[model samples]
Target: MQRAITAIYRTRDVAHLVRDELERLGLARHHITVIHKDVRTADPNAADTSGTVDPADGIVPAVGTAGGAYVGAGMVPGAYMGAMPGYGLGMPAYSEADLVYADAFDALHDLHLPEEDTRTYQQAIRNGDYVVSVEVDEDADIARIQEVMRRPEDVHDLTELDKTYRDAVYAPRRRPPREGYRDGMMGRRADLQNSPTTRDYIREEPLWPKGGTA
Candidate 1:
């Protein structure tokens, strides 16, 4: 598995490039994951022409007529502000404006957060914008292989998720995202809590041992 945190390639055609690279590296197609990068902007004219973005120097400012306006983000300004120590003998520590437009640009371009799940800046992130885009588990071929024992992962010892990672890293609850909505403090949504599916599945899993002869 290629576990290194390497972009290896940056392009609008990231999905295609990733598939090609995995084949070149002689890895099974099922093992590759392409971290996509998508840009959101209201102005079409100002979007970069070449589709080339330099991570270090790219300007993520919402520079429009007067002040930049970001779509899908309700962050006009003054939403988030923090202090910054001024660089002078007696000067006071200046503060960072709650500039949502500026922050989005920096997060996507500067931090190379083209597509990640959690945002380092939230209110900046509207409650419903596609920030990070991860492809749904496109490992169907791998799953099929495993079912036939060509690959074996289903019957291993109980391997629970990491406590810290699951409890905290996963936003709503210890459950997976597709599990459904969760309530305050991250409990399962009431409708699904003690669901019949859960109750039935636990008692009816395909876990019986086969009869054997010596």
Candidate 2:
């Protein structure tokens, strides 16, 4: 069965690094996706539309409108216009940011994740955090991808976040600290290094695939 494993990162750079590492692990680039806020925009709520993956190469294209206008495809009309009044008179009705947010939300919803979890991730992206999702078939691949994502120094596991939210909302209970929490917030590299399949795959595949440089 195919399933998605998603996590949150503090920055776009770290999210990209995680994606690259996943690709190095023999996961297809198209199976991975990253959504984050557009730092170039002064508005914190604006999302980066360029983060959408191109179906041709599974890469985020460097495309954007010149004056903060949305001009590409997959736009959701009136997605945000209804929320803000007076947008029907002279405005473009929807900004590029609005379209991207709608796209991001739609992408996350397609994963079939829980409604609250999806909303939580959307809010995180709106708050400028990066969300990286990987689609996997085999259980081993799921484990491998999760290991790679969590190996990042400051990545947050979505499952853990969900658990924390549930615990806070339902019952406050004492929970043990996460593994490697005391080790300067660094993930355990030894775990991945110890995996025989991971070692062999890393040896077989070039870190950078042909046709592009990471």
Candidate 3:
């Protein structure tokens, strides 16, 4: 089994340099995977006129919106977390953490890394730098590639790669609150409950009546 030796680079230039060197050292170019931030590909939510829905769209995104429904509400101990049948409060888009992981591990399953290194490579790319992972069949190749890619100022292992990436990318920055606009779960719930039509329905029949006022 081949082991993956991976490192993160601060720049695409250096990442390409190391990749070329790895090829010269006898590793095949196809054996190396380069991961970097691509602005064009970053926005999965970008308007898609293509009409093809990504399968992941159903899995990861639906988890949040459907979580409440799956858990159930009204008399259930965890009612607050669950959605009622008619309650269409809202669903959240993907979070930064989930998207980062998804992007970092894109197509990684096909690379066939050794079991131990799979975890290492997955965690190393979370910082969002140009990450390179090469499948080397020999221990000697791992040593050579590491030497070729290691920077004098950094630790060379995953830790230093993560540090370099964090320094380069500022992530999960707070979006400026919408001025005078309600947002987030509370806002969405309030909007749903207060809508003229929904308000009438809730008042007349109430999906989950509180204190017999329905």
Candidate 4:
């Protein structure tokens, strides 16, 4: 049976280094995954060659504008200000942070961890930590994987880290230009609530050439 072993790092750099080390130890890149926030900024000088506005950027504002106009005209109810599109209901759209949380949750869920443990792991990611998980088919490789991942100085034991940050709160520093409506509609949107099954943000493909198992 394949089993997953995971570790948390305080920074993405260290987590990535550890992942490289794991690959060096003969684990297939596909057998390991990293879950973290998408912090990359788009280059301003980069031409919009695609000439496409991201839906996340475009749709939310349109919804808010239409909703506001209708509400002001007394045609639509005020309660539906931030309702998400395409659901045929007034569900709020998820923020980028929420999507990251969902991605982290889905990645952890693949391990079949207990619900509480999964939440704790997800919270770790939300707290600006990076998660590196490895799936090993051989029981003998578990110890080696753990050793490699935990060698970093800033690595933390999940439960202990949870206790340290349990009372702390996280607020995203940046928001998309038109996210005001979404934020006003729903702030923080239920804290790690969404459990999207798709691994939209995972890195599972083999990064190294095919090789024999460790």
Candidate 5:
């Protein structure tokens, strides 16, 4: 089985150049995946092309605008200040405004990356970074692939996302319902809250069935 290695870049143009370089270095184009945000349909003139942006910088103003608008709308009734159009700090990681526009490209190839790797790349792309993943079976090839794609300053290191990615990918698996557990309030109450990893809510008093006899 081939192992997947990924990298993130700042610009779509650079990502394309790296993809071409990877193809020339014996890595099959089909084995590479470039994951990025799609923004082709956006008005060409509407984009903010004023060089690089810090996600934190945009978040504050967007939040202030939303908060003020919400308050104004509540007071003035028909007057509505719509939500801020772009992403800024404090918003969820992958919200519409938080997305960074990527170069127009079709995902013709699939790297078949592991779930963990895919999650890692997904976060990077959502953070407005361009991501590239290449599969290689040989250990030596890993270094070569990275070397060709290396822009140390530009690469979004997967190591930094280890904690966040693992929590997102594995947390759901840890929370699967216990055997024979149902789905509604009945199940929630009956289910033994045993897992130490999650919150525990058990007591001698009956808190269900609308005031049941304890």
Candidate 6:
């Protein structure tokens, strides 16, 4: 089986997360190499199933060697990192999910999709969708997604994504602020207005005991 590593993140947390996922998926530590780009298609035979294997992810690793190592939050199946044809943009792509397979490299690219449907790509474009070449130069494989977007004349205020995000942000809080302590805590006035004991003490002053006048 061919092996590779791709770090689809800038921070160590992302690297760790991908590593954990790979390990969880049964890719051995030795079979893994870490870098900044996906390398599933460098070889005509090697493959990536993460849905982001692009033609520009640099060179292919030798069979049994980890392909490429990198990190990114948008690393999805069939994600093609680097730049490619017909984009007409100056900045390169930032996010690309490497779709690895046991057979060969499959490319995924934006531009072909409508502006809205290609969000994950736009996010990568704006962000530093990292692609560090380990054993080869990165090439963003350009592939098109075959999905239909259903635009409506009305707004979708009830989208699940919106609801979930709002729920997470504005959910009823579990606990409230501390309460239950409001008494005199100040100065000469506090002495007069404070605890019942303090009032009693003041009333029994020696100079004016009970109803006695001096």
Off by more than 4 A, model 2: 39-100, 157-214
Q: Given candidate 2, what's the lDDT at residue 66?
A: 17
Instruction: Residues 10-36, candidate 6: write the lDDT tens digits.
Output: 433443444444445443433332332
Model 5 lDDT tens row, 88-107? 33332222332222211112
Cα TM-score per model: 0.21, 0.50, 0.41, 0.49, 0.41, 0.20
Candidate 6 Cα outliers beyond 4 Å, as residue runs: 1-9, 25-40, 43-107, 110-117, 130-214
Error of 5 at 210 (Å): 63
**Comparing 3 and 4 on TM-score, the stronger one:** 4
* Segments in model 1 whose C-alpha atoms lie over 4 Å from true places: 1-9, 19-38, 41-75, 79-133, 137-139, 142-214
Residue 161 lDDT in model 1? 16
* Model 6 / residue 113 / CA error / Å: 9.3
lDDT of 1 at 166: 29
- Write model 2 residue lDDT over 40-149, tens digit each, in one string: 21112344455434434333321121112222345445433232344434433434454545444444433334446665676666657777766554344556676787
lDDT score, residue 147, model 2? 72
User: In candidate 3, which residue pairs get closer than 3 Å at backbone N, Cα or C atoms, i.e. clash?
Assistant: 68-82, 68-83, 69-83
Name the better of 2 and 6 by TM-score: 2
TM-score between candidate 6 and the true structure = 0.20
In model 6, the Cα lDDT at residue 107 comes to 16
Q: Model 1: how far is 118 from its true place, Å? A: 4.0
Which of the two, 1 or 2, has more lDDT?
A: 2
The count of backbone overlaps in candidate 6 is 57
lDDT for each residue of candidate 4 in 1-214, tens digit (9 for 90 to 100): 2345667778867877887898799876655666654322222333323222232221111111211111111212212332233322443333444553432343344333444445556677777877676655534455566667765477876657657656543322112222232212211112232122111121232212234221
